[model samples]
Target: MKLETLSVRIGRDVEPMAGDVAPAIHMSTTFERDSDGEFSRGYSYARADNPGRKALEQCIAALEGGHDATAYSSGSAASLAVFSLLRPGDHVVAPIESYHGTAKQLRDIIGPMGVQYTFVDMTRADAVRAALTPATKLVWIETPSNPMLNVSDIEAITALSHERGAIVCCDNTFATPVWQRPLRFGVDLVMHSSTKYFGGHSDVMGGAIVTREGGTLSERLRDYQGTAGNTPAAFDCWLLRRSLTTLVCRVRAQTENAARIAEFLSTHQGIERVFYPGLASHRGHDIARKQMQGGFGAMLSFCVRGGREEAFAVAGKMKYFTRATSLGGVESLVEHRASIEGPHTVTPQNLLRLSVGLEHADDLIADLDQALASRS
Candidate 1:
């Protein structure tokens, strides 16, 4: 079935108790056992499994074409689950510029735990290949990386990791399954901060990891999830499941808006550079063209003519684009990413990241135009 069909139909098979089309949310913390003291339904406890979470996991697995998926309370929890698979003295390779939270986890949290990691420019596959060693257990790829919007070649990196006996995990938050399916590129695992695109409305917070083959790594993550107990609430799972129904439509609309905004920024005198894979001028245009399916993506970033002060001024001048953190929502958001990422950030002081939303392209452009003009 097509992604559109799968998004809406995959989890709708539940037998609604009241003849309602919407799937019911099982809010009970625990399920009853049979009179013989044996488990009857597939579920025994909410922490171990819940109907809503199971439906969401099934939906995400079907969408990404993965063998199975594990849902988490937050995207960070999902990252931690994957990192927990690595033992002391194990090595990992990741992009130099990625979601700050994930990078921090690898560098600060996991690094001190005895696991080693190397951060390299993943856009250059040679850099990644050079960073790998016999000790390397995983290669983390985040195409169209956060803030910078640097697109990495997933297939190239995956092949290199496979040659070295390292599992490859792709962070697919920026490029949702509607745009790019990393599992199709032979990535061993695909991860997402479902709080962003999957949640769509910015109300739900969740994370997920889908395994292509469901091997030992998948088993480990499942075990860690159950034991650690960092699982999404039943209502959050239900909300995420509901959001999937319109994932394709929402992302496509945002993609179109982003393209228009990027084009506008490219020609504007106040802008120094635009980071959008959809733009022909982007360094990753050709590779993105090959990997991404329907659209480039809604996320983009640009450097204003001056430095931090000028960038903050521009962000402050926006009328429609809310000055906030987080992305992949119906409403547009603009952020001075450097400030948001704090003192440890590598994002340029002059750069502002934009999360193009479902707003009309012209209105968003006008808001940007006014902001840029005010800066001049």
Candidate 2:
């Protein structure tokens, strides 16, 4: 089946007893055992496994063409689980311009746990190759990277990492499986903040990790999840599965809106640069074109003509786009990237990241036009 068909049909089946089209939420924390003392139903504890979460994990794993997957309470916990796979002295090579939270987790959390890391410009294959060491256990890729929209060549990076015995994991939140599938490009693992795209709305919080070959890594993640009890609640998992049904439709409309808005920003006198992989002028356009199927992405970032204060003025003037943080929601959002990342951030002072939503393209373009005009 095509992705559109799989999106709606993968995790859903008619309930046996209820005969309901939509699956019911399995909220039970424990399941009954047989008189002979066995869990014949394949689940025994909520923390270890739940019907709702199992459905979601199966859905995402199939979407990404992976062998298996595990759901988490949040994207952070899922991320931590991957890092937890490494012991003290394990090294990681990561993009210099990734989501701030990922970088922070490595620096503040994983670093103290005795792991070593090197931040490199992932767009440059040479830079990534130069950073690898004998100790490197993982290579982290985040293409159409947060705030910068830098695209990494997944096939190239994967080959480089694999040659050196490193596991390649990608943060696929920005470019969901609808746009790109890292496992197909030789990535060992694929991760998502199901809180964003999978939920399709801003209402739920969850994360997931899918494995390409389903070996020790997949088993380790499952073990860590059960032992640590960091998996999402039953209701959240059920909601995520429900939201997956419309993922394709919502992402397509939002990507169209983003392309239009990006083009408008590119030509505006008040804007300095628009960071969108779809635009021919972007540095990573060629690679993104090859890796991303239907569109670049709904998220983009632009720099104002002047400095931070001027950028804030344009954001404050926007009528349709809300001045806020987080992305992959039903409503559009604009945020001053540097401020949100804090004083130690490397993001430019003038950059504003936009999460284009399901609004009509003309309306979003007009709102941006007026907001840019306000700066003049």
Candidate 3:
């Protein structure tokens, strides 16, 4: 089945109950043992597994063309699970322009745990290759990267990492499986915040990790999740499954609106620069075009003409776009990323990140137009 069809039908079947169209949320934390001393239904405890989370995992695995998936409490938790697969002294190479949370986790949390990481400009394949060492166990790739929209060549980087006997993991939050499936490009693992796009609305918080071949590494991640008890609640899993049904439709509309807005910003006099993969003028346009399907993405960043104050002014003046963080929602959002990322942020002070939504393209453009005009 196609992605659109799979999204709605993958986990909809509920057996031995009423013929309800939607899947039921199995919120029971523990399952009863039958006969002697075994759980015949394959569920013993919530920490190990839940019916709703299992359904979600199957659906996501199908979408990403992976063998299996493990859902987590948050995207960061999902990332940490992968890091947990490594021991002390294991090294990782990641993009310098990654989501600040992921960077912080690698620097502050994982680093102290004895895992070493090197931040590199992933857009340059050479830089990624150069960052690898004998101890490098993983290479993290984030295409159409956060706050900057820099697209990296996934296949090229994956090949480089494979040659050095390292696993390559791609953060597909920005370009969901609907746009780009990294497993097909030889990525060992694909990670998603799920809270952003998979949840569709800004309500639920969840994360997922899908493994291409379901090997020992996948088993280790499952072990970490079950042991650490970082699994999502039954209700959250059900909500995410509900959101998956409309994933393709929402993303297509959001991407369309973003393309229009990026074009408008590129031509506007008050804008210094626009960072969107869809834009032909963007540095990664060709690479993004080659890899991404349908549309570039709904996320984009633009620099205000003056500086931080001018950027904040534009964000503050927006009427339709909410002045908040987080993306892949029904409602639009605009944020001065540097302010949110703090002192260690590499995001330009003059740049504002926009999470385009399902609003009318013209309305979004008009809001941006007026916002920029206010600064003039």
Candidate 4:
């Protein structure tokens, strides 16, 4: 089935339990077990497993074209699930420009745990190939990467890692299942902060990790999620299930709105550069065009004519696009990337990342037009 079809069927189908159309939430924290002290389906507690998460996992795994998936409290939890597959001495390669929180987690949390990582220019296949070492166990990447929309060559990176017996994992939050399926390309694992595209409305917070091979890595991560206790709530799963049903529809709408806004920024006087995969001027246009199916993506970044102060002015002026963090919500958001990433980070001082929402494209465009006009 297509992603559109899969999205609708994936958590919404309840197998006619009492002939109810939508699945009901499982609110019980503990389950009744058989006399032998085993669950009917091996589920004994909410932290270990639940019917709602299983439903969501199966649905998302199907959409990502993977064998299985796991859910978490936030995208970070799902991300940690993938990283848990590594050990104290393992090394990993990641793109230089990434979400600030993830970068901090890698440096602050994992580094102290003795897991070493290198940040390279993933756009250049040569740079990725050179970064590979015998101790390298994984390659973490984001295409149309956060804050800066820099697209990575997945095929090259995956091929490079596979040659050395390393697993490749991608954070597909920016490009949801509607636009791209990483498993189709030799990738071993795919992760998402379901709070973004999967939750659509951004009301719920959750994360998911999907893998083509649900072998040792999947088993270990599942065990870690159960033991580590970062599992998502049943209510969040229920809301996320509801969000997935309309995932494709909202993404299509946001994509259209984003394209118009990006084009407007490209020509506007207050804008210096626009980072959108749809734009022909973008460096990764060819790769993204080849890898992705329909629209480019809803997330974009643009630099104002001046630096940080001017960028904040533009963000403050947005009426429809809220000046805040996080994306893939029903509403739009604008944030100055450099300020949030800190002065030591790679983000430019002049840029603002925009998460295009489901608002009318003309209204969004007009607001941006006026916002830039106010920058003068």
Candidate 5:
């Protein structure tokens, strides 16, 4: 089935008894036991299993073309679950230009646990290959990387990782399944902050990991999820499942809006540079063209003509885009990348990240024009 059709159809079965089109949100923490002392319904507890989470996991797995999926309370938990599978003395390779939270997890949390990691420029396949040690068991890829919009060649990275006997996992949060499917490029796992596009709104928070094929790795993920007890609540799962019906439509629209906005900023005098893969001048445009389908993506970032203060002035004057953290929502958002990342941030002081939304391209452009206009 086409992605759009699948998005709406995946979990839309009518309730057998209620005769309702919308699937019922299974909220019971525990299920009934059979006379034989077995949980024949296939669910003994909410932490172990829930109908809502199962439906969500099934929907995301199908969408990503994966064999199975595990849902988590947040994207961090989903990522941590992957790291948990590795033992002490294991090594991981991750992108230097990635979400700060992921870096923090590696440096402060995972590293101290005795699992070492090396942060390299994932945009360069050779760099990644050189960084891998015999102990490396995982290669993490975050294409269209957070704040920077850097794109990595998934097929190349996956090949290198597999050659080294390392599992490759790509964070598909920025590039939703609608545009890119990492599993298609031989990535072992695909991860998402379903809290972003999957939820389609700021109302819900959740995460998910979809495996290319079920085996020892997938089984371990399931065990860790149940034992950690950090799976999404029943309502969050239901909300995310309902939101999936519109995933394709919403992401495409937001992508179009972003392309237009990127174009406008690229030529504007107040902009030092626009970081969008859709632009031909962008460093990763060719790789993105080869990998992404439908459109580039909804997220873009640009540098102000001056420094941090100038960027702050531009953000302050914005009339439409909200100055906020987080992305992948219906409402446009603007954020000063470095300020939010704190003192250790490698992000350029002049860079401002924008999360384009479902708003009309023209209105968003005009608002940006006025915001960047001369104040004298």
Candidate 6:
């Protein structure tokens, strides 16, 4: 079955709960073996495995149209598991404007671990090709790239990388499973900071990895997920699992709110630019439209007529849209990106990124209107 159809129907098929009713929380740290010092099922323990985590993983794997999935403590943990696949002296190529934490991981952390990397502007597929080397083990992609909203052409980069026997890893955080599924684009792996959209409520901090087939890749990742000792707690796993039930609905609503807000901001008197893939004015709008389902995601950014001072006042003045950093929650969040990163960071001073929420569109618009008017 297709992922969209399966996302709504996958976890319900299992008889894990009584008579196929709502699933209960299994907070077990360990499980008993049947006999002969051998266990008889797919799970053994909470650290290595848990029934709750398994349910979520299976559902997520089905959503990504992959054979297997593993859940982690955070998106960073999931990414670290993929990075461990690279050996010392291996080469990695990633987008220059990808997530900042991911960039730090490659340059400051993994690079010191003897891994070499080249940060190229991913909007240029040719640049990715030019950076390729025999040691290139992976190409990391972040579509609708962070902060600035630049998108990469996954089909072109993934196809080129595959020819050289390198894996393609896409961080599908910005475009949730609801909007984009990278596996369909021939990506080798799909991962999510499930903490964002999958959890849907911003209450759980977890990550997940999905692969096309369940084999060595699955086993290797599971081994790392276990060894790293960063697996999500049973409670967190259960929370995330519960969040899955409303994933589609919440994302759809948030996307709708985002589209309305983006449209308003696009031609607003005091706004200079809006960076939403949903907008036809966006450079990535066509590619995002071609590859994505439904709406382009709830996250977006817009620059004010003035720089940092004006952006800060705009962010500070919002009443309904709370000024916060993390996104993908039931409530709206607004942030001054450049302030969060300080002086040395890449986020521009004039930019304000928003995580649109389920609030009434008029209220959100009111908040924005007052905030922008205050700046004017």
Model 1 stretches with alpha carbons more than 4 Å out: 14-16
Candidate 4 per-residue lDDT, tens place, 1-376, comes to 8888998887677456587678888878888889987677667889989889888999999999899898899998888788888889999998899887777878888888999999999899899999999999999989979888988988888999999889999999999988998898889899899999899886889999998886897888788889999988999888998788898999999999999999988888778899999999999999999898878989999999988888888888889989888899989999887887865589889999999999999999999988888654
Candidate 1 lDDT over residue span 1-376, tens digit each = 9999999999778574677688988899999999889887888899999988999999999999999999999999999889998999999999999999999998789999999999999999999989999999999999989989999999999999999999999999999999999999999999999999999998989999999986787788888889999999999999999999999999999999999999999999999999999999999999999999958999999999999999988988899999988999999999988887866688999999999899899999999999999655
lDDT of 5 by residue, 4-32 (tens): 98898887778889798988989899999
- Candidate 4: Cα lDDT at 277: 92
- Write down the TM-score of every candidate: 0.98, 0.98, 0.99, 0.97, 0.99, 0.95
lDDT of 6 by residue, 1-376 (tens): 7554666566655564466566667787888987877888766777888877888899998888788898999998888889989999999998878678787788777999999999998988889999999999999999988888887888889999999989999999888888888999999788899888888786889999999877888889989888888899988887887788788888899999999999999989899899998999898888888888867999999999898888888888899888887788999999887776644467778999999999999999988998899555
- What's the distance in Å from true for residue 182, model 2? 0.9
TM-score of structure candidate 5: 0.99
1 versus 4: better TM-score goes to: 1
For each candidate, the alpha-carbon lDDT, in order, equals 0.93, 0.92, 0.93, 0.89, 0.93, 0.86
- Which stretches of model 4 miss by more than 4 angstroms? 15-17, 374-376
Comparing 4 and 6 by lDDT, which wins? 4
Candidate 4 Cα lDDT to native = 0.89
Off by over 4 Å in 2: none
Error of 4 at 346 (Å): 0.9
